[model samples]
Target: MSNESSVAAEQGTAPAAGASHNHNPSPNHTVSKDTRRRVVTASFIGNFVEWFDYAVYGYLAGVISTVFFPESDRQTALLATFGVFAISFFVRPLGGFIWGHIGDRLGRKQALSLSIVLMSVATFCIALIPGYATIGVMAPILLLLVRVVQGFSAAGEYAGASAFLVEYATANRRGLYAAVVPASTAAGLLLGSLLAALLSSVLTAEQLNEWGWRLPFLLAAPMGLIGRYIRTKLEDTPAFRELAEKDDGVKAPALAMFRTYRKQLIIATGAVLLNAVGFYVILSYMPTYLSEELGFGATESFLATTIALASYIGFIFLTGIASDKFGRKRMLITASVLFILLTVPAFMLLDTRNFLVIVLVQILLGGMLTLNDGTLPSFLAELFPTKVRYTGFAVSFNLSNALFGGTAPFMATLLIGMTASKLAPGWYLVAAAVVSLIAVLFAAETSKKPLLQD
Candidate 1:
């Protein structure tokens, strides 16, 4: 079927025979059983590919440091590698705004497809680019350019996918379906970490630095192709379709969000701080911490993080199921409180020399982080009406992530350097978690609310 027919079919029958808007009982209209399942699966897979492409950078940063800045000092080379990481984040808000508009106005399916394609091309380019030895400064400059493209593409991947899944699901299953986004992310991180570890183990350090590092980035092309195919088969969410039919879809969703949903924008931004900060701390930075701070080799650090992340994937789905059973607010509250209390202790324990203690700390920390990660997508998505849900979610999520999440490792390193103390970054995590807890208290409980009812 054509895209227009698919969108029309997704909108369902509008309010049957002149029924009043208030009288329409189905808040998101109605979705076919098959459409609903396809949307969820497609959302998960698209997000998976996006994250896998983005995260391979961090997992392979050491090799990237060598390739991109071959003659630079060790610190300078590492800084250049992370500079590319931060550069990607800087463009996320633009990605959020542009793609969020498409999601809100045109359709979520289109936005999802667009993001995957952009990310796939960017990742493939990174894999194929010549090194500093061959191309001088142009190599690193080109790498930076591709990273910007990645950041822009990834900006919409999570928020758009979550909003699509939540809008397509019944109210009772929103949390469970929304959790799929983060589950896919956790799965992606796990996959990337495992690939990095396996490659590092099988290949000598010289071989990995020389050429094996490109393999994971090249692999992203196929995953992106699979994601595009899955998303192509999926239908737009019922809520988005309904809004388009009513002429309620805003032409500029980002502007509508700032004008109409400003309060929600603030609250959602604040609520996501814990998710952004906590996730980056546990997933992206942990390997760095293990390798640099704890003096573990790269292979051991990867194994620990990979194991912890595998466990994190399980908790993500479990927390989502719990949110549906208990409520989103309660799960978030419990998570925030635990995170605030445990942040300092977890990091301190991780710093200890005992591997067993470090393993235990990782499990506890991963579980606490999962509490917010698993629920925030639905919690944030539910805060706004259909007309600006994507805008509200994408802008808030990406802005906070760019400002806080993307800078986490660099900030942590800076703080530790300045203080001569390893525990300083934990304070940052605790403080952010506290702010998130306060925001969660102010936001309304959305676990049982219908997607379009707000």
Candidate 2:
């Protein structure tokens, strides 16, 4: 039989037999067609809301600076805003710990619902926060507090969502199902970028600085609510249900992860560095690079990024679907190698004044980043058993992101300023890609194995 036919046969047989052994309270926990659809949609929306809230800060950083830190010099205020952006990352590990523990102990659905609630409340609070003139120094202070909350919530969203999808999906479809989470992330970025562009187009810069920026943050509340509803309705994953039934779920998953899966943890963390750094560089820093270095206007930068973001969303889905058919390791290795080779040329092309060349570079760059991102969840999740899967995945992914991803734009700026070179970040990109390539080349492939069979 072909892979598709074999997968179909296995999915049909396993769920019926597995359901009898699994102890999930919901009858819908079986791997039926409807169950797979529900799981994929729930994971997608949950990740979408998490990233949508996070991406808005980068897209609207200039307006946020004007509103919350109005009294400072414009440059200083922008620095403070980006600083707060970086500060939020420090809270991710805490979020990861809390959500990972809960997910391992209770269930992925509950953990996901709590994360969305925290993120939505944080995003809404930012929308309603008074400007500096109205609230004095408390405005920025309050902003930082809310950002920490957002960071905390975000820590668990991806890991939980990925685990949820992976455990619920058929083994043959793991790569495809896992890809949806990152695809949703890219979708969120696209949505956030489009909203920022639309607002920038319609409003005067002064008006946007004063009030328009809050609209996107406020928009997150509804998305969060919808995600919460969908998540709460989801049944726990089959792997978790089976583990819980056996009383095999780790009580202190984080501790267990450190003691037992330390090597896998390191490998997973290394794997994320390239994708995390490249993602932030392309998505978050590109606008600033265009506006500050290339002398593009704010509106023009937004428009350019918006177009690139749309292309990125399409490429994310394509790369993700392709990874399933071609094997995750092969696709990831190809992406990392291509990224290492293209980093210089891509940046140089981006530096050109021709709009067509810039757009083409952005599409290819976005696609390259998507290559690893689409496959990472399955690759990392498969590195550990179910007992510490959530903890292992969360800690490794978030720490790398905090250390590398969160600082990409900030470090790139400092590097360019010090060197008087626009392409200094290419060196950082190449170094990270090299590390990721080494890790992927050495790590065992898990695409063909059953998720919890180990």
Clashes of each: 0, 0
Q: Clash pairs of candidate 2? A: none
Question: Candidate 2, after superposition: displacement of residue 57 in Å?
Answer: 0.7
Q: What is the lDDT of residue 130 in candidate 2?
A: 95
- Tell me the lDDT of model 1 at 226: 97
lDDT of 1 by residue, 1-454 (tens): 4332222223221222332222122456667887787777788888999999999898888788898887766656666687778878989988889988888888998999999999999999999999999999999999999999999999999999999888877778888899999999988999999999999889998899789999999988899999999899876776766666777566777876776567778878888998888887789878777887678888888888898999999998899899998888898889889988988988888888677787778888899988999999988887776777888899999999998888877777677768888888788899889989998887766666455422
Predicted model with the maximum lDDT: 1
Clashing pairs in 1: none
Candidate 2, run of 10 with poorest lDDT: 13-22
**Candidates' C-alpha lDDT:** 0.82, 0.80
Candidate 2: list runs displaced more than 4 Å: 1-29, 70-75
